[model samples]
Target: MSAALLAALTATTPAAAAPPHWTIAPSAGGGSRPAAQDGRPYIYAEGAPGSVLEDKVAVTNPSAEPLTVAVRGAGAPDVRTKAKGPGAWLTFATRSVKIPARTRAEIPFTVTVPAGATPGDHPGAIVASGGGRTSGISVHLRVSGPTLSALTVEHVRVEGGDRIAYEVVNRGNTTLTPRLAVRADGLFGGVLDKGPRTLPVELPPGRRVRLTEPWHGAPALDAVDVKVTVTAGGGAGDSATATARFVPWGPLGGALAVLAGGAFAAYASVRRRRRKGPGPGTGNPRSAP
Candidate 1:
């Protein structure tokens, strides 16, 4: 056998491979429930727009082997894309850490809220990544703003009996549990008068949701104007209106037809009486003679 051929037979080919992402799932520090009762693998912090808050996060490694991970703060991924909020404001002590097998590490961090920060929830994440694999703990940050409720109802319309469709907008910086009071008025008087009832919704700031309200049996024949008034926590409230016309066209047409027939009969009776009178005189002049 040739030397070159023997070398080729023993040669081994390499396969493509990449590193994996890893991180520890965040939990409450005390192992008890969070203050806000939000059960998420996240760091929750609240502060004013021009303030700074401090907190510590524990990163655990349940793996059997030793590993070195890069710990950093990254922008929280929004429903649409990455958020450019609190993530940009977080500052960490160390950028990387080496952990032994089956151990945990505690890292302290501070969040500095900008004076001009928007008053609302700003999300971010603390990521631990190595060998291409990445894991993250969510950061829920709320910047303090005026404690006010602001809500508005829009695009209100009556679909049918008791079925009112409307859109509610949250124009405040907090989550709201809204209530609705639907009232309807007709040409004669009020038809529906429903007081405020708690809505089955949780509206986040700057969000809009469409909902329907029920009415058992609405007016059968009348022109109605519907008004939907909504209110919520923080004194947030607004009103909107819609119009509906419900008439029994079948009965109306029949009644008009009967009146027209009666007028025709009266006209025939008058014509018969005129024909019996004298032609030129047009009246009964000495009829007996």
Candidate 2:
């Protein structure tokens, strides 16, 4: 064979390749539930230890060959995990589980937050690995314990008339029933009125409710200081205070009217003096007689 022919044949032939192309992607399925993806998944439950929280994890097969994935638990000592059928059941230590590729399966996992685990938030992550590819995802767990009801007055503003509208928000994850108390103070820092009013509201986590306090005898006040205190379910221990400005339109208008009248009177008096003939015959000294 000629050297050119041999070189051409060798170049035309295909070379040995590496392993099959494999990739991992997160997904969610089952019922109307929303799945976590892009490195974050949200799991919600209200129970004691050994309680299972079921969630779906998705695995995709982009390669020509089928791949088997392993879903595993990772993170802090208070969490655990195990595979539940196509998915995984995470116990106290189970944070994550895996699913197979090319078939796209949903894995169910249970999170058993140990007893006495801080009533606030416990953070952990679940990892899925297969076909020489691996990715880790985080799980947000909120533990519930004794109800610590708290209330916060997020915003306060005075509208038309003697009405004061306030926005109260419950920053805690639990529901809260709030009772609000509002006090109006003059610019000199003197309390104008104080009363006990019940503002019933069942606000969920990160929710806000508006309350209006109409002062039946609020004297016309312009730019007065206001202080608001909120108590959850009449609990004094969990209260919040906020201060704002209260401007009354009626008083402001009256002040503006008085200023305008003064300006008008001054202008009219100057015009009348100019029109009168320089004090009863005191004519312009520069004019010809």
Candidate 3:
């Protein structure tokens, strides 16, 4: 062969093989898990607003020899690793992970939910590159808002006169303006007290408040029922019901006399019934009377 032709052929020819080697399995991580072979892998997380999620990556060495895997890019400033020494989110930590022949290792990356974080879905990935070879995996994450709120009314009681008091609370993230409705029945007859009274209050994130309403006119007798409703922006609203005992007022002496008379009447009625007992029973008397 000519010298020039031989040089060109050598340059174009492929290099000789060294030894038998193991081949990496395609889709070894089942397409769901992220795997790092020659280079870095990427993953994703999804969370709600003010929520957190985590993504993981695995490195596998298919060869017969032990493989030393060094993890990096987690602490990088531009990287979004939610790790902190204390009270931090989206954190990641890993030492030199050694995967023995036909073995694998794991590395985790966490994504923290941010306070006042906007509501939406976010996408991120972890790049795992090493050993002169590279591979990438993707991460998916989502964030959402407050689902619902629980409201309760407790200890509703009527004071000395016709005054009523109860408690109102907002167990939600958003502020609330509760509309209260009072209804009383039983001895006082059916009556409805409806008002669009604004509470003139702002409840911020996990707070409670006490409310009192007074009823004029005749004192309530027997049981009194109160129904309360709460409404707020974003079409968030709730309702609750509470009951109180209403006491009637009268002259002290007169009230005492009435109670005594009622008790005496009840006792007399019981005695009369006992005396008239077994009237129609045909039984053997002690001595035929």
The best candidate in terms of lDDT: 1
TM-score of 3: 0.37
Candidate 1 Cα errors over 4 Å, as ranges = 1-26, 30-43, 50-112, 120-140, 160-162, 248-289
lDDT of 3 by residue, 1-289 (tens): 1122223322322336432132222233433345567432334344565555554556777777776655432221111223221113345557346667887666665667676543333333333434444333333333466444445555666565556677766554433556566665555466556565666665433446677777676244566566655566555566656666655455656889999999999999999998887676556757665
Report the lDDT tens digits of candidate 1 across residue range 164-219: 99999887766688998989999999999999999877665666889988877788
The best-first sequence of candidates by TM-score reads: 1, 2, 3
What local lDDT score does residue 203 receive in model 1, on the 0 to 100 scale? 69
Q: Write the per-residue lDDT of candidate 2 for residues 1-289, one digit (tens) a residue.
A: 1122223322322336543344333344521245455442433444544454545555566565666666665544422122221112254223333333345555655665554454533444556655554554544555666544555775676666467778876555444556666777666666556565666554544456677877666555445666777776435324334344555667788999999999999999999988874685576567578
Worst 10 residues of 3 by lDDT: 78-87
Model 1 — which ten-residue stretch has the worst lDDT? 1-10
TM-score of every candidate relative to the true structure: 0.55, 0.40, 0.37
Give per-residue lDDT, candidate 2, residue 239: 34
Off by over 4 Å in 2: 1-46, 49-148, 187-192, 233-289
Question: Candidate 3, which segments miss by more than 4 Å at Cα?
Answer: 1-150, 218-220, 252-255, 258-289
lDDT of all predictions = 0.72, 0.52, 0.50
RMSD of each: 14.1, 17.1, 23.3
